[model samples]
Target: MDIEYSFNKRPTTDQIIELYDNAGLPRPTNDKERMEQMFENSNLIITAWDNELLVGVSRSITDWVWACYLSDLAVRGDYKKMGIGRKLISLTKEKVGNQSMVLLLSVPTAIEYYPKVGFKKQESSFIIEREQ
Candidate 1:
């Protein structure tokens, strides 16, 4: 199993949709506006490839000077724990650099994972879900 990492490279809309599908995240319809908004306008996207297969994706929306909100991070289930996810996180962290604060909202499962990458538990935050 030879795996390679490519960072800061933009993946196509179809690639994103497929990766999201494999990760069990939301899949997009044929709407161009939603398609255009993939990755949250993240100029910084990290992807991992196992040969031609997309194994991982990490997206962040950052100002490059202050704070960065890591919107989504996923790895195909078969590819999990192979360092692909860590590499994606590393690449995204490097892109954000030191000037920006990295932020994310995690489900219970991620609480252990995030702290391994230098994220601390934060209180005093609230969320209002969008109408879907």
Candidate 2:
């Protein structure tokens, strides 16, 4: 797999929706505007591509100094078990540097996966669920 990684390369909305669906990430793929805005507003984005296919992505909001919220991490279903997700994360951290901490709220299925890639489980976090 000759996967190439890019920082801040925005994938098309269709590509992102397809990937999120394929990866079982459970985002609002049905709402195109929301999906488009999601990526557009994100400050940091890491993408993995296999030739022309967008295979993986990591989307984050960061200040590049103190904290980075890795809002989305998705890899194509067929591309799982490869290191694409890990590499996307590694690149996200690399871009954010050591001073900023990377954080994310993992999907239930991925709760076990995060720790393997260097995310510590934080018990103090809280969230007000989105009404949508």
Candidate 3:
């Protein structure tokens, strides 16, 4: 498959919702407004496409000098195990350069996947639960 990758090319909310569903990544697809805001406020977005299909994405917020929070990383279920996820991460880090470290809060299913992509496991992070 010839997969194309793009940076900061925002897909429509409908496309995003479809992709999240197909990828099995749970998100607030029921609330289009919130979904739009999520992508709007993010500074970095990298997406993979198979022709017209949205197959994978990596969304992040970064300062380019200190820290980069990779908020979302998803690959369509049928497209998994094909290195698209790794490439998205590679591209994200490439854009951020070496001055900043990339961080993400992994869903339980992805805890093992991160280490293979060059992320060191950290137990020092903390988060207050989101009420929603």
Candidate 4:
């Protein structure tokens, strides 16, 4: 299908919203606020686009010193298996550098995919709901 894409370290606001929305993943009601925090706290984020269309996204929170978390990776369903996700992961990891512990959350259906991109199981994370 001639998928044309590139990895970007700092994408525009429109690209961020578009890819995150098009990824079809369940996100929190505060996704917009959370994304703003991510951009502020994260050392780097990678956005992949197929031509001009926002198709994939992956972001990381890292210190480039000890630890990193590869969070919020998603690609459009129509763009799946096209290496867009892989490319985003690669770009994030490369930016994190070696000697950093990297991690991510994956669904049961997606567990196998991350290992191929150089991730492994480490520990479990959780969230406790608070009254809103």
Candidate 5:
């Protein structure tokens, strides 16, 4: 099935949670308000659709010139291995252009996947763990 991709098309909370859950990405799915804020706060939102079904999404916050933090990249389980994730990242890079760098914090399971999609593992990055 061909996937239709779009930019800044903020998905409904339901669609976002569904994708996150099915993709095995840990998110506050039960908290509707938090999910709303997650998408609401992001500036760059790319989505993939399979004839009205939300199958994949790449959400990021960026300056559009300096750096892009790709916060979430999720695709439904059935859609995995079809290069949907790769395409989402590629489209995101296309949007931000060459001057800006795209960065992400990979979940333990996805550490290997990111490098395959043109991400170079960096050693100098640091993060203060989110207080849950």
Candidate 6:
């Protein structure tokens, strides 16, 4: 697949929602406005595209010099295991450089996948759950 990766290239809300839904990744895809805001508020967005089709995305909010919270990583179901997600993260790290570290909260299904991509399990992390 001739996939092209780009930084800060925001995919349309519909494309993002479709990808998220197709990948079975949990996100507020039902609310288009919130989805739009999610992308709009993100400072770093890495997207993988096959021609015009949005195949994968890695969205994050980062300080560029301190830490990066990678809030989402999604790829079309058909495109999974093809290294699209890995490339998106690799590109994100390259852009942020070594001064900052990438961090994320993995979904249950993806819990075993993160460590394979160089993320060490951090036992000291804590979170205040978001009310649904």
Candidate closest to the true structure, highest TM-score = 2
**Candidate 5 global lDDT:** 0.92
| Model 3, CA-based lDDT | 0.93
User: Rank order by TM-score, top first?
Assistant: 2, 3, 6, 5, 1, 4
Tens-place lDDT per residue, model 3, 1-132, is 999999956789999999998887878989999999999999999999999889999999999999999999999999999999999999999999999999999988899999998999999998998899
The per-candidate count of clashes, in order, stands at: 0, 0, 0, 0, 0, 0
lDDT of 5 by residue, 2-111 (tens): 89999956678998998899999988999999999999999999999999899999999999999999999999999999999999999999999999999999989999
Q: lDDT tens string, model 2, 6-116? A: 885678999999999999999999999999999889999999999889999999999999999999999999999999999999999999999999999999999999999
Instruction: For residue 52, give model 1's deviation from the true position in Å.
Output: 1.7
Q: Each prediction's TM-score against the native?
A: 0.82, 0.98, 0.97, 0.74, 0.97, 0.97
- Candidate 1, residues 65-125, lDDT tens digits: the string is 9988877888897887877777777777788888888888875566798888778888977
Q: What is the C-alpha local distance difference test score of each model?
A: 0.76, 0.94, 0.93, 0.71, 0.92, 0.92
How many clashing pairs does model 4 include?
0
- The local lDDT score (0 to 100) that residue 110 gets in candidate 3 is 93
> What is residue 88's positional error in candidate 5, in angstroms?
0.5
Q: Report the poorest 10 consecutive residues by lDDT, candidate 3.
A: 7-16
Winner on TM-score between 3 and 5 is: 3
Model 2, position 40, has a per-residue lDDT of: 87
Tell me the lDDT of candidate 6: 0.92
Query: Regarding TM-score, does 2 or 5 come out ahead?
Result: 2
Cα lDDT tens digits, model 4, 23-113, are 6655552467766666667656666665677677776778887888876887987888888888777777677778777777786668887
